[model samples]
Target chain A: MAEIIGGYFTSHVPAIGGAIQRGDQQTPYWKPFFDGFPRVHEWLAKTQPDVAVVFSNDHGLNFFLDKMPTFAVGAAAEYQNEDEGWGLPLYKPFKGHPELSWHVIEQLVADEFDPVTCQEMLVDHAISIPMELAYPSVAEWPVRLVPIGINTVQHPLPSAKRCLALGRSVHKALASWPGAERVVVIGTGGLSHQLDGERAGFMNPEYDRFCLDHLASDPDALTRQSIHEMVRLAGTQGVEVLNWIAARGALGPAAREIHRNYHLPISNTAAATVLLEPACGVWALRRRSPRP
Target chain B: MPTPPRPGARPEPIPGTTLFDGDAARKGYHLNAMCYSFNRKENREAFLADEEAYCRRFHLTAEQRRAVAKRDVLGMIAAGGNIYYLAKLAGIFGLNVQDVGAMQTGRTVEAFRQFLLDQAKGA
Candidate 1:
């Protein structure tokens, strides 16, 4: 059986990313956010995982309206985080585990997920931002990366269920990898937000709390809602929550909530992080009815 | 606006990486937002009239110019042209790259542009 080394959830907000890149992590405003993850930091210091499955949506960097791919996987040798200048010092590019990554890819294809495969892929701030948060120990991070790029911004965004299904499939793929050990799967995105137009700074703490509650109990249930409702209640950009579904689905029905944190920083958004640990077996998932 | 490359300019692969060459892919998420935004028939007239001016405004590089000139969709990406620019080229060539990414995970230039604008501000 595949041993899920727990899962992590976070956001790729550029402001937070900028703060880290500029080396201003010590700033008072950013302190609470960092402190909230003491358990997460401690876990990383202890496990020092060998691989991180980063699920991030791409910026317009590679996928635009003309040729956006919904689910593209990066099987590159190295992936770099762009320091969009807000002072996050540029870090060395993260190396990838192509062998294991490809194995998982082959398995997914066999399982019927038509994943977009790429050898040369450019990851924008969206992916990089989350990496900085989850693995600050870049110089010595034990994790090799497997990048899963999603298209969250363009039209025809994946349904929440689609994102969740992708996550579950990832688990199926990982279970069959040969000799690959010590892996962490991360789902990153939003609690609530609207980063565009006159409604740019919208926030919904109520919805954020409600969404987290639903995800912990039954992510599959949460995945059934439409993006329109999310935008109306949570804000247009709040649709980012769809990305989190991918993470939640991978945790499976038996996933136990380890740590959860949600906060509204800079007024326009609510950022949250959740951790899930898988235990027991597929038998539980097969026999279980989703809890609400 | 710069004239279209005269015939026979020997279209080269866009100067950077594709989804295949992970070793040297995009240097940064840095992109020209105007490219994708202006890549529509409605906006094509304005785009052509002020192409060079617009490229300069966005601080686009020479490589990007060649990518757009050749109408090399993949090259536009490999050569460092931003989605904003590539989208515009796609508009001209009648292709839609943003839809491609969307089919998988659902995305749009507006979301990307917003993210970058946020970075440009916070950075």
Candidate 2:
């Protein structure tokens, strides 16, 4: 039986990559936010997990309005990186653990989550940037990728509770798999930041802090809050808060915040990351060691 | 092996039926953006409650507003938003992405796949 070793929370901000690509972290706008993520940089260096279940939203690359899957799970052996002309460098295509992916799909569906299983999906910033951020260039990626897409591009994205429920289902899927393994489930996107419409470039660090605290301790409290208020505070695109639920939910009723960070660069996002370890089983070994 | 397309290949604009071609995409954007933006039962109800004000913000006509207010995403989209924006709108509205496609082209899988491929090519 496999155990849920831990979970990661991340913000998939394209602007961060843009700044990295420009190599201008020292610029007034980006310095503080980048400074906040040292623990993450240190953590990835230490306890690198075997597989990462990545949840992100598509930017009209793979699933468009024509045929959107509310929740798309990659059952394919591999996924192609569609060049959206982002000019962000690409690497060898990310490999998918179809065996594990298929098992999780089968179990999640059987668990009544109704996951949309696909033979293939393309890599977009939703999955791409997070991949770059997690498995940095200097280090080779040891973890197999399971790309789960949330329909954040459109309205009525899955509720935070639903994404959390999906996370619980993913945990169930992992628990029943008959294999030797460690797992890291990641929920990417949002903590009260919006980009688009008249309310563009919105950031609410206060709300973001509240969201992080709740994620570590009382997420259901945040889940019970009204969507209008979430939008009002987090921005309309802020509904991506649901993706955070998936990560929080995978942590389940028993998990601890190993480390957490939040920063709003006064740019395009309210960035944050929380590292969680399951309340039981080998958590001590998973505590992020000091960086080399 | 080719099958015939869906019963309604393309929506024929009805006088009062709305889902007009000229404003379909923008209407779709507004409709779906609202969906993704508001998910709570109350937020959804509030958006639906002040349909006219929201429509006015988007500058939609009474009929186009009605299409979305009625939850006719296919009709609202068929009127004229970019399919990508339409897809986003559909997601926000609590409608399944594929169902929105189905609603637009009558759910012929082949037709929907073609729509996706064509979109990829255009991009």
Q: What would the TM-score be for candidate 2 when compared with the true structure?
A: 0.68
For all candidates in order, the CA lDDT equals 0.62, 0.63
In candidate 2, what are the lDDT values of residues A203-263, reduced to their tens digit?
A: 6666776777778667787777555456676765566777778766765566778887666
DockQ of each: 0.04, 0.03
Give the lowest summed-lDDT range of ten residues in model 1 chain A: A82-91
lDDT per residue for candidate 1 within A2-104, as digits (tens), equals 3467788887765676576577676775765666567787876776667888787765555654466778888988876542322235555778888767876
Candidate 2 wrong stretches, greater than 4 Å: A85-87, A281-292, B1-26, B29-123
- Position B108, candidate 2: lDDT: 58
Q: Model 1 — TM-score against the truth?
A: 0.68
Highest DockQ scorer: 1
TM-score of B chain for each model? 0.43, 0.42
Task: State in Å the error of residue B3, model 2.
Answer: 41
